[model samples]
Target: MPPIAMPPGLKLAQDVMTPAEETELIALIEGSGLAYTPYDKGNTRSSTSYGWKYDYANDSFVPCKPIPEGFRTIAERAAAAAGLSCDDFAECLLNRYEPGAVIQPHLDKPVWEHVVGISLGVPTTMVFREPASGEERPVELSPRSLYVLADDARYVWQHSLPPMQGTRYSITFRTFSAEGLRRLEACPAEI
Candidate 1:
């Protein structure tokens, strides 16, 4: 396949975390004691939200558990790598994907703006598609690597993960958009 040019505002950094850090993050996720709920087809993708929970069933956002210290530290690094401020990140989501689990193509909620994601445990390819044009691009994500989606990449294209070779965990951080900020101000958050 021909190499696909990355869309504007999409950035990826390789080896953002050391193997030791990756191991530690995985351990922290395992010990966090947060509820992981399955929301995808066949119950293959389970996730827990921090700072704010996204109600997939209702397609709305709600306040949830605060971001854990371990994740917060990494999120800060991710924010810096993405050229964003850690303070701007208001939500964190941890997704656990079982082998062969797939995430269908879809855009994120408009309430969120920039997105930073850290990949762990397994390597996988994320395919981004332009809905109107149907043009697709595939980006491989290695364990401990980080990827950022903003601007056109965040709003114009839809992204999804194909079936994986092994269990994988993605730690995602998102910043609230103007609309999200307004909503946040109106809602009483847990933290």
Candidate 2:
């Protein structure tokens, strides 16, 4: 397959999902019976994890439920669009951001190679910063759009979203590294 043309390590597709599709997906997430919790520390957003949950205290993945069917469908389509293998992703994190919620700047942990995010509800600006140059680039995330971060963007640049204007949600799909896969397998609980 030809590589998807993208900016260095980032791929973005706007209007990837229709409004109705976005609404349906959001409803599915809300009704999925997953445990959505606030960041144990200080974050304002709430999130639910599938396949693996990050244990902030231990800095590792703990067993979690399998990815929901609705999320799997979206992840598969986004992976195909980004020129990635659908099976590569084994986890999904669903985040719900209320108005005034903010995400701090941080690079995704090394356990996950690629980060694919599907934006729903409302639009927001996601800012990416180069660690070496300290330069910043802001991208507007339109509702029903998809963004993928890989390579340098995944490892070198840190991304964040400012306080939001309205309630918004994002579904992020992540692929585990070899070590991460082993960790998941070694866990006693089924994921």
Candidate 3:
């Protein structure tokens, strides 16, 4: 295949975790006991959040269950792959995509800075689009691989996933932007 021009500040790292680690994570996620809520245009996809969740009505992130200890090592590794420290991230979103599930094209919320996603289970393609140029780039996300979106890729491009032939899971970590930090400090001590 010819080289593809990826958006600036976008990074992809393969084999971030061993197959055994991936299986352990899947087990942990399955047993987390968190309810999965519908996402995107239709109710085809579902997700659960930890550390923090965006409150659409309030336009701020609210504290949710903290990132579980079981995921600490994975999170630390993901942070290193993104050239950041684990403490830099304040939110973790777990998504479960059943066969035929899809994610509509959209940018990450403005209050977020860097976004890192670890793909697990079945492999799938993530499409990134530059709205101004009407250009779309497709990147394959293999199981256990990780991707990071920062700067232009995180702010200028919109991304989505098409319907998949098999089930997949993603663990996404996000850092707060300057504005997000302010809003986070204003959050109540208890949720």
Candidate 4:
């Protein structure tokens, strides 16, 4: 991925919690397996709970975790980051990873609507870039931190957490209205 300057209204924030909070968060991810997944080492693929599929061999969004919080506070922040309020936000999925797990590089794919992500638990590095220009930038996200991707960031860029060796967590923020959910049978989301 190439490195393209972020557009206006974009904010990437890190370290949303204190060290004590980070420790507590690590306990949450390791214990919950929000990162719980089965990996095909030969193919480098894994699954969480979202029912989204991932084909690491091809670097595509196959399937993975669901938005765990159902689009709560963090969703609000993501919306805010996009210049929208909570009303414009929709769902959230928690990516929980334990030691020695790896997620391949791929974008969220267009099937879903909008997306937002926050890093939590142990720190992790996310790969990003200007999709059109092939510019790349790798960012390390800390526990309790928030990342809002919208506008050109939404359609023009690709992102992934790659592989990691320790406990790590990522909460993705997404948006779709109730009416919007009515349009998609699978999106009502049991809040």
lDDT on C-alpha atoms for all candidate structures: 0.83, 0.80, 0.86, 0.56
TM-scores for the candidates: 0.91, 0.88, 0.93, 0.63
- Per-residue lDDT of model 4, residues 43-152, tens digit only: 33222434333334553333344444433445566676667776554444556666665666565555445666767666777667776778776766776787776666
Model 2 lDDT per residue over 32-102, tens place: 65453535345557778888776766766787888877776788888887678777776788888888888
**Candidate 4 lDDT trough over 10 residues, lowest sum:** 43-52
Predicted candidate 3 versus true structure: per-residue lDDT over 1-191, tens digit per residue: 98778888899999998999999998887776645453345545667788888887677777888888888998999899888999888888887788998888999887888799999999999999999999999889999999999878898989999998898988999988898888888787635
* Best-performing candidate as measured by lDDT: 3
Q: Per-residue lDDT tens digits of candidate 1, residues 53-124? A: 767676667887778778767888998987788877778888778888888898888888888999999999
Candidate 2, residue 173: Cα displacement in angstroms equals 0.3
Q: Give me the runs in candidate 1 sitting further than 4 Å from their true place.
A: 34-41
Clashing pairs in 3: none
Against the true structure, what is every candidate's RMSD?
Answer: 1.8, 4.4, 1.7, 5.9
What is the alpha-carbon RMSD of candidate 4 to the true structure? 5.9
Rank by lDDT (best first): 3, 1, 2, 4
lDDT of 1: 0.83
